[model samples]
Target: MAIAIAADELESLFDALPDVVFFVKDAAGRYTHANLTLVRRLGLKRREQVIGHGVAELFPAHMGGSYAAQDRRVLGGETIDDQLEVHIFPNRAPGWCLTRKHPLRVRGKVRGVVGISRDLGRPDARDPTYERLRRVIDHLQQHYADNVRMAKLAELAGVSLAQLERHFRNVFQITPQQALIRLRIEAAMHALGTEGSIADVGVACGFADQSAFARQFKATVGMTPSAYRRMTSTKE
Candidate 1:
């Protein structure tokens, strides 16, 4: 005999984890369940405030639109796994997270979506590859404005490409490629706060061009570079 757990029980279990945001959404993209971490991040005091709302109702316009679009893809049967993202916390601070979303199937039919966004934890210094990965990270930070190659990173770490990827995920909870992208994005975000043109910033951040930079920035930060700059300007 198999035991079935209730959604409420699962929600409660997830609520106990302070660093993870968990949710279930119906086919219409309305939230059916949300953990406390998500609620608090959205600046809500109670679960009821989040239970029936959609992303559009809870997040800023640009970010809400991006999240809703992602939900639509999931509703259409796409699975998003271990996607690196920058999530906005309650005080408008951005934090790194790895998000996963899957179509919830029931009785051979897709019913909804279930997802989790876990906060990126501190890297494990005890991992044997930590020192090697540290060197790679240092190089990324120092040279994010230049064209970066995974093969070069592998060589720097003195490991095969496969081992480098595995070690990065094991220690940092992200791939070496993701680490490089994170560095570039961080630099771009800082530069966006200046008066420099978006295109120039894109190229200076090691993106192939403006379009690629805008695409990656919007995909990870949930807004276009100009929109982000405007928002940040308004805040300042």
Candidate 2:
């Protein structure tokens, strides 16, 4: 005979999974139910505080905007399968996660969204291939101010250029070159918080010139370096 779990038992199971965050939100994007993982990650003392709030009320503006958009997509009867994403915790830490969201249907009509996010631990510690990939990542992080060649990265990983690219895509869903750019941009962002000239920050981050840095930074971060610095400055 098949076994069936009761509703309360199913909820208890969700609460027991510490590494996974589970939540249900109404079509209007208000939280209806949230598991203990979500509650703790949001730094809430009780679940009741999260029951009626939306993402915008809890997360940083940019991250909250992204979540709100995804909620709209799910409510429109779309299912978002496991996708890698960067999530910001209430403690202001950011990490990679696998996120999935599906529409909650009532009488054949989409009524809300149900979602889960599981943290993906440090890339280096995950698998053998990932350990090799980590070597390349560490090298890039240390030498981001230098012109990093793909061949050098591949050689470090003991793989061909093509194999290195495939591994990066499989693990991070981004190419090695893209990862390099992301690293450079992140470094530049941190440097911008200091009292350095924009041109200096650009060059320090390995861009060929200030214009090139500006273009790439704007493309990747959705704002000019100067603007980002000013915005973050105000917050601080």
Where is model 2 poorest over a 10-residue stretch in terms of lDDT?
A: 1-10
lDDT of 2 by residue, 66-147 (tens): 6787798899988987655545565545555568899988779998888888775444445559888888989998998999
List the candidate 1 regions with Cα displacement exceeding 4 Å: 1-5
* Backbone collisions counted per model: 0, 0
Residue 203 displacement (Å), model 1: 0.7
User: What RMSD, rounded to one decimal, does every model reach?
Assistant: 1.8, 5.5
**lDDT tens digits by residue: candidate 1, 98-173:** 9999998887677788999999999999999899889999999999998888899999999999999999999999
Residue 21, candidate 2: alpha-carbon lDDT: 85
Task: In candidate 1, list every pair of residues with a backbone clash.
Answer: none
Please report, in order, the local distance difference test score of every candidate based on alpha carbons: 0.91, 0.78
